[model samples]
Target: MSPATSLTRNQKLAALAFVLGVALVYYASHPLLLCRQLIIRDDEALYARLHLGNDLPYAWLTESDYSFRLAEALLQGKLGLTEPPPEWVNETIPLRGRYYSVFPLGSVLTMLPFALAHRLIAFSPSGAAIALIGALATFLFLRFALRCGRNFRDAVWLTLFSTLGTWLWTNTAMGGAWQLALGFAMTGELAA
Candidate 1:
């Protein structure tokens, strides 16, 4: 890689900082957190520092848990749910004795690692995973923007606009089934 094309040390640090900022903003954009609800009791100690109350798991926010089942099925080498999903899975369809998610496989595949983690150690990974995808997608955008322009600061502003000024803000923050897929699609587009 040519020196002119590659990021300098300060530019790399700035890009990483931008990614971290994106992650923090997206995670805090959750509706419950935004409202400053007393329901975010978390192990991270962040809520304590912020002086917020509430458990981390929000029911509406977890409507996308069905996505994990699809990811898990893929891990097991199946395109369809071999075992029936829980009764609460609303957006699934039963076809020819097989059940599948209404969301496409691509979206489900994006969350594959989170599903694998949940299956392996029974740790809840969806919340962390969504923020991670959001960060990764933003990081990709920063790289692309910097490549197209010579100024890293200008790239940061453009990237911020793309993220904050678009529907991505709501969709990625909501963390719903469709939203999760959209985040993956955006990341895939940025990657391309």
Candidate 2:
């Protein structure tokens, strides 16, 4: 192939990669997937409340274990905490007489933008944000595949397989607190 033609082809391939990555992420992050509450005992609900300016340190005490805490925290007033609940009794970090999530803050930090957007728009945006993260993770995996001397086609296949054909898909789509944390950790390692 001519030099100019090869360059143009490469550019096209790069664009295709980006577009496909974005489209797949969008598809996976739909609210339909999020509304099902596949995993309830997750940090996403807590983070969402925190981003919306609700008191996080004490909210968990009254929130039901089976109910959608994010929706309740957003719409309802905080219930009076007469006593620490069973869930909170064991998992709290006491700081300055306030309790906090035992989970790390990384996942919450990652979802901050989405939480803010959701707060503003009155809709959950976690799915989209998680999808974007997953897409970026796929791109990083693609780069890693290329650096390992994979052909363009093979690298693309590897990226798809790694992101979609593994637990990565479940974590990204579900966007549960622990799942997202695991996804972010794995993606961070891959990107690094």
Candidate 3:
């Protein structure tokens, strides 16, 4: 074949390799890592509230315990707590009968797309979309690696190791509030 054709074919092969490598890493990590329940937890619940436009009660931030508040919020037709839990009764923050969330909103912003889709689909699988995000992050990492002058083979290996052999897989699969937040942050940073 001509040189141009050979180069084009080689480029296609490289692209295929990159895609397959990312897929392999994502699959080997399992679709769900440490998540046991489909119900949202911790900061994830807060993010869900944010997505639903629910007001976060400031009292919930007084202590680490949030399960009861979340349950109450869900029961009250609110996405998050509407009242302060007992633990915050003594605090001096002068809540003035208002709800709030102490956590940064970055993670919630990152999860908005997924949250919106979940809202649209009544029965969408809970953790699968996050796994896909992890996979996308791996793909981006591979592309970034290649752009940094690593050979295609080296880039593939590096991407695999970074995604599967590190906390990236754990966080991506677990779907914890912080883990998902960190994953999105890393993915965004790499893309930038």
RMSD (Å) of each candidate, 1 decimal: 5.9, 10.1, 10.6
Estimate the overall C-alpha local distance difference test score of candidate 3: 0.53
Specify the highest-TM-score model's number: 1
Alpha-carbon local distance difference test for all models? 0.71, 0.55, 0.53
lDDT tens per residue, model 2, 58-104: 43323222112222332334322223435534554545544445555
Candidate 3 structure quality by residue, lDDT tens digits, 1-192: 332233357765776565665555554443232222223335455455446343654433222223223333444465545555455333212255655444354543454455455556742222544556666776787777777777666877887788778877766554445555676678888789
Worst 10 residues of 2 by lDDT: 61-70
On TM-score, who's better, 1 or 2? 1
lDDT sort, best first:
1, 2, 3
Model 1, residue pairs in steric clash:
38-53, 38-54, 39-53, 39-54, 39-55, 40-53, 40-54, 40-55, 41-54
- The stretch of ten residues in a row with the least summed lDDT in candidate 1 is 55-64
The TM-scores of all predictions, comma-separated, are 0.73, 0.57, 0.55
Q: What is the overall TM-score of model 1 with all chains considered together?
A: 0.73
Expressed as tens digits, the lDDT of each residue in 131-160 for candidate 1 is 786698778777777777648778888889
| Clashing pairs counted in every model | 9, 1, 6
